[model samples]
Target: MIHEHEWQQWQQQSANHAATAAFLLLDVQTNLTMLETLQAALDKIRANPAAEPYSLSGNSYFIQLQPHRVLIEELYGDDYAEPVTLSLDDFGDALAYWHTQI
Candidate 1:
């Protein structure tokens, strides 16, 4: 359930040849602040799957918090279409690692 993805390198910059986006996976890591926020959001969703699906907005990402997963319609450097189902335990593992990272 740790979703794996490959980024498409567009040699030709053209919208006509654009590819459908892939949804966000739980393992990506970067800015510490954002990572913490995402982890918190994940915790909330897992704690109360019944309270969703709601939205979390920021300068770059816009996530749809579902029962057990998040839909990243506008991740800064990613493209997403169908929602990616997640394995919470794996995601938590990533988050744990993220703590020791930036």
Candidate 2:
């Protein structure tokens, strides 16, 4: 279940961008509880990776790199068995930089 604060945020964003998809960017190591909450939230909306249209839920996904192993999972949509992982420490900054260029 989504918390009251998160629900309100989702509602506000949905209302503000009716035609655009909302994405949830979170730090995987911020907190264990928060990570679990995010995982549950994403699981609720996850889609089959093999389905047509190949869409994700709410435009949210997770990326993690540990040692030589890179893990990628669609937090709210379809995901492939293997995820494309890159070397990056600050996910938010990378996303923001990409957004500016795009």
Candidate 3:
């Protein structure tokens, strides 16, 4: 299991990435890279504006040698949250749902 400090580090790094819109070093999987995920998320944000009816949106960032994935919720009013989990499906669904609330 990953230590709590890792989560804190990830949170800080994520905040930095969100601000700079730059690629971040995340744990990678056999098929996915963290940088790739961040890029995809950036693309999604660009494509979907935070307007009424489409406020729910987020990005799934991965890490290497770890089972859990990070769910970054881009909520309305500039209030965002990152909840880490081991299930990709759950993160994806939750992000989709969150986007609708915005």
Candidate 4:
């Protein structure tokens, strides 16, 4: 499980991108395959070009994807939150990092 400090540190890291954040969070929270989450995020973006920064919310986290970047936000209580933004390349790096972790 991810601790609060680790989550906060991730948000501060300039290297952490959208795909990395999504995969890490999902891996901890569910048994779904990583490809499933990646495909879902891509599908959401392709299905709604107008929603450039489209978002998907899970029980405790949310991810917003844009053409060149992505944002991952972790929700706490009713209003508290932590968010991180990443470029496409950084996001790819993040995905690779998580894959290794698994």
Best by TM-score: 4
TM-scores across all candidates? 0.47, 0.24, 0.23, 0.52
Model 1 stretches with alpha carbons more than 4 Å out: 1-29, 54-63, 71-83
Q: Over 4 Å off in model 3, which ranges?
A: 1-84
What would the per-residue lDDT of candidate 4 be over residues 4-74, giving only the tens digit for each residue? 44654654565344335654665433433744565466556656756556666666566677876777776
Model 4 residue runs over 4 Å out of place are: 1-32, 39-54
* Candidate lDDT (C-alpha), each: 0.48, 0.34, 0.33, 0.57
RMSD for all candidates, in order, please: 8.3, 14.6, 14.8, 6.6
Writing each residue's lDDT as its tens digit, candidate 2 over 1-102 gives: 334444445334432221111233333323445444434433332333232222233324444433322234445545343344432222222333324332
Scanning candidate 3 in windows of ten residues, the lowest lDDT window is 19-28
lDDT, residue 91, model 4: 57
Highest-scoring model, lDDT: 4
Candidate 1 residue 93 Cα shift, in angstroms, is 1.7
**Predictions ranked by TM-score, top down?**
4, 1, 2, 3
